[model samples]
Target: MPKMKTKSSAKKRFKITATGKIKAAAAGKRHGMIKRSNKFLRDARGTMVLSEPDAKIVKKFLPNGL
Candidate 1:
């Protein structure tokens, strides 16, 4: 049988932590930032760990890691 391939888009968007948790950037900061509040921009600076259920889905796409 052939080896399973990872999802390319998911590979770019999700990251695997040292402990195997999925980390992702918060959404809603791509455009229209001029109208957004300072607090919202400040709060979205770092990556966030996905929940267990969501992480399971993402793990399937990152077979080899980033």
Candidate 2:
């Protein structure tokens, strides 16, 4: 059988933590930050865990991760 490949896009955008949770960067902070409020910008500056349903799908792409 052929080796299963990891999704490169997923690998770049998400990370599996030591506890098996999908960690990802919050959106809306990539560009045009000058128009957003300080609070909004600050809020989008960290990682967020994927929701259960979403996590299930993410897990498929990152089988060895979580």
TM-score of each: 0.83, 0.81
Model 1 alpha-carbon drift over 4 Å, by segment:
64-66
Name the lDDT value of residue 48 in candidate 2.
92
The lowest-lDDT stretch of 10 consecutive residues in candidate 2 is 57-66
Candidate 2 ranges beyond 4 A from true positions: none
Error of model 2, residue 52, in angstroms: 1.4
- lDDT tens digits, residue span 1-66, model 2: 887889988888888888888898998887899999999987888899988788789888875864
Pick by TM-score: which candidate is best?
1
- Residue 59 deviation, candidate 1, in Å? 1.6
lDDT by residue for model 1 over 1-66, one digit each (tens)?
897888889988988889888899999989999999999999998899999998887787787642
Q: How does model 1 score by TM-score?
A: 0.83
Candidate 1 residue 57 Cα shift, in angstroms, is 1.8
